[model samples]
Target chain A: MTREGINQLVEEHVPKLVETITTHIETLTAPQRLKEAMLYSINAGGKRIRPLLLIATAGSYGSVTNAAYKLGAAVEMVHTYSLIHDDLPSMDDDDIRRGKLTNHKVYGEAMAILAGDALLTESFSLITDISEQDLAPRDALFLSSRLSEASGALGMVGGQVDDLAAENCSLTLDELESIHRRKTGALLAFAVEAGGLVGTSPKEDLTHLRKFAEEIGVAFQIKDDILDVEGDESAIGKPIGSDVDNKKSTYPSLLSITEAKRKLRNHIEAAENALKSLSVPAPALFSVLSYIELRDR
Target chain B: MTREGINQLVEEHVPKLVETITTHIETLTAPQRLKEAMLYSINAGGKRIRPLLLIATAGSYGSVTNAAYKLGAAVEMVHTYSLIHDDLPSMDDDDIRRGKLTNHKVYGEAMAILAGDALLTESFSLITDISEQDLAPRDALFLSSRLSEASGALGMVGGQVDDLAAENCSLTLDELESIHRRKTGALLAFAVEAGGLVGTSPKEDLTHLRKFAEEIGVAFQIKDDILDVEGDESAIGKPIGSDVDNKKSTYPSLLSITEAKRKLRNHIEAAENALKSLSVPAPALFSVLSYIELRDR
Candidate 1:
């Protein structure tokens, strides 16, 4: 599949996933105002990169089951919750996100906090919904457990802690890499592994999936850093150099853009090799890898 | 078991549950600052009312097991996370809890938010740890699902939203009741039901437990309302007139203190009747109900 093909696939899956997310979230008896706050953020456009990654891998296993949408929604909720919390005045203090007012700016900090929390709690319930012919309750439990691990202190939260601690401080390249791997890489790993877990991928195939996830995860982070340095702010829906405002270290800061791009290419190549090692033909996964490499924003 | 016996039970279990929570949270690679923030809140004493309810229910059924501590800890984590978030400036805006500086006040807002997230996420993982015992992974999933339900927008968050929305606005008694039922009652219900769930209590006993939880939950809220109006500020670890400062409606505010006491007694009687119906003798649960009625803070 071509890179454009993957982009198209992502476009298709994103709306579907959003629809599912909206529907599931609406089922909760939250107050009208809180629901409105949550929906405002949920409708805000993200590339749905995490869900897209899960779907691509699931498709490769011929396992595009309904449960995948539920899982996809769960991951998306987790991602959305992090974004909401990160945008708080006490965190990034960003007033705008996704080309619009940030959650805290529009909803107020208290509501924004609650909205983020709602999304996180809702994510767990959504994962438990992954029960049917294709998935058992135990399978749902495993998925939920893995999601928890990825998002918790050992994964995304831990990484964020490290990232915050590194602010305005010079960090060794290895430390920077460790932070990226934990903060962003953990979720990416979960996204890739989720597909296989739901599809019941063989152990070997799961290993390949993990390899693919690790390489692309680092590449994705590097690209994000590169974009922060040079991408169009409007297209990115955030300021290009807000990383500078945070005084946080980034890939481009640690290594020149040229050097970061070189490292990015290295990880992309590793991803390609991992994709090739998959027992099943995974053109969709390959397309996703290419998209990560070539995406400008 | 008498009231003293129940007190002994709480004393014995609270530390063990806190120990379990500490051990599991330590396993996360979260930054030291974030971990400190979380531990600070988790260590704050809130009477550990929720976990005690669960242990009491389990004990009465002769169903006490190693897994009870894990479940108790998970409930405690959930309770702690809510307390942390609720105390945030955006939420209840309390600066102190348990007569100590609140999490955000001490750790700053970002760390407090992340700490809450970590505690909540780690909770699901702790439940999954129940897998190696007599319980199945499915049971863990069920417990997690229920906890999410209790804590999510539909439960605690939803109630909070309503509570916040009601602030500085006139509220009917029914509206006030709904808010309490969702905010505090949902978690209390979850705690009571959890004991029966992990112990696999008989269906009739589970029904009775739900009934008991419902009555006592309302009674607990009423008691809290009474304390808010009349509680010793230092003993309560918060300002006595906070609800008044927020211009919020309360049971004592709507019903006179005497009327509120009447309502409280009605619920306590209902809880006693429910406990009487249970297949197992639940002296500890009865003691808890009585304590709720008699306590000043």
Candidate 2:
């Protein structure tokens, strides 16, 4: 798939995934407050990168339908939950996300918190309920574990912790990489690997796909740092220079733009190379990975 | 087991369960904010009814030191997460839980939200990791589904929503029961059913146990309503008539005190009768169900 093709594919998948998520979430009972909070943040648009990754990864192997759809939706649920809690007044305290009011602002902090909790818990239930034909017990368990690690203290939560701790403080390049690797990279890695696990991607190929995801994960964050410094706030739909305003260090702050761009190119190249090792054609994955560093919004 | 013996057994289990819950929560990432929020609310005291039901149910059939321990701890995690989210500014907005600061007040709303999310997600992972010896795949799945039902919208979340919607409004008795059944009864039912699911309890016996749990669950909430109205404030640890102050209707408010006591006794009898059909000597469950309405505080 070419870059334009990948974008079209992602666009097509985004609404379908959103619809599936909404339908599934509507099944949840009383916590309409929490569900509303989840729906608010989830409907706030992002690139739909995580769900796209899951679907694209599934497509890379064989097909992306039925059970694969549930898995894709589950990953997005996890991603959305993280973003909701992350934007809380006690955390990043952001007022806007994806050009919309933060969950707390719209739903109130309690509902926002409960909604995040509900989404997180509901994601596990979603993954575990894939029709028997889609995946087996052990595989479901494996995918659940991957999702857990990605979202748990060892992964995104850990990264958030490090990020918060590092606020108003300088850090070595390696430390920054370590932080993003767990926070952002871990979930991205899970997105790719969960696809592999569900699709029964070969062991060696899984390893390669994971490496590809890891590189792009860090590169994606670096690009985010660059965009935060130089991109249009109206286009990005979030405050530019907020990180700098908060005195938080970023790739652009630590490395010159030229150096950061060079590093991003290196990672993107590495991601492309990793795709070559996949047992099946992965043009879509490669295309998406390439755009991560170059997209303006 | 007599009623006194059941109380003594529960008394013995409380510290161990609290310790386990504390230890498990402490393992949450060292993000001081998140950990502080989790620890603050979790350390607060409660009845530990869910854990007790789980352990007692498990003990009724066989030894489940390892299997029941984790399930007990996991249930507490879910319960605690619900409480933390419930007390958020957007919800009940309570300052104190069990005589200490609530999670949001202590850790800020953001961290409290994230911490609750973490605990909720981690609960499933904790349950799924139960050794295969203790719970087969089918049983594990069953337990997961049960827990999900108990905690999800049809259960706790549903009740919470009704409670929120009815805040400062008069509630009919049927509406009150509907809320309490989902809010408190669902988990209690799960507590007993989960215990039986993990044990060698007959299918029929499990059904009866669920009935028993449901009765006691409603009865338990009624007792709480009564206590909130007439019990000593210091003994209850919550201000007397706060529910009335909030304009939330309770059984004591909806029914005359004498009529409310009659309702409570009726539920207690129903709970005991469910167990009467069970041939197995589930002494602990029997005593607990039998004496549910008579307990003070």
TM-score of predicted chain A against the true chain A, for each candidate: 0.97, 0.96
| Residue B66 displacement in candidate 1 (angstroms) | 2.0
Candidate 2 Cα deviation (angstroms), residue B247? 1.5
Q: Flag regions of model 1 displaced more than 4 Å.
A: none
lDDT by residue for model 2 (A1-297), tens: 457966777776777888888988887655566667677787888887777777788778877766677888888888888888888787888999778889888877766766776677677778767776777776676677668768876678768877887889999999999899888888888888877777667877978887888888988899999899899988899989898899988888899888988998898889888888888987778767756866787
lDDT, candidate 1, A1-297, per-residue tens: 677887778776877788899998777777988888888898888778899899888888775888888898999899999999988988878888879999988889999999999999999998877665768877788788899999999899998888877889989889998998888999989999898887777888877888899998899999999988999998888888988777878888888889999999999999999988888888888888888888877
Candidate 2: the clashing residue pairs are A30-B158
Kindly report the fnat of each predicted structure, to 2 decimals: 0.85, 0.39
lDDT agreement with native, every candidate: 0.86, 0.79
* Superposition TM-score, candidate 1 onto the true structure: 0.98
Per-chain TM-score of chain B, candidate 2? 0.93
| Candidate 1 per-residue lDDT over residues B1-297, each given as its tens digit | 356765787787877888888888776666778778888888877788888888888777776776888888888898899888888887788898778899989888889899999888988888887855657777777788899999999999899888887889989998988998889999989988888877778887878899899998899999998898889988888778777788888888898899999999999999899999988788888877877777756
Model 1 chain B worst lDDT run, 10 consecutive residues: B1-10
Model 2 over residues B1-297: C-alpha lDDT tens digits? 356866786776777877777776677554666666666766777767788888888888877666787788889888988988888887898887666777777777656666776677667767777778777766676677678778876678767877888988888889889999988888888888888877778877867887888888989998988888788766656667888788889998899888999999898888878878886777887666654565555
The candidate maximizing TM-score is 1
Residue-pair clashes per candidate: 0, 1
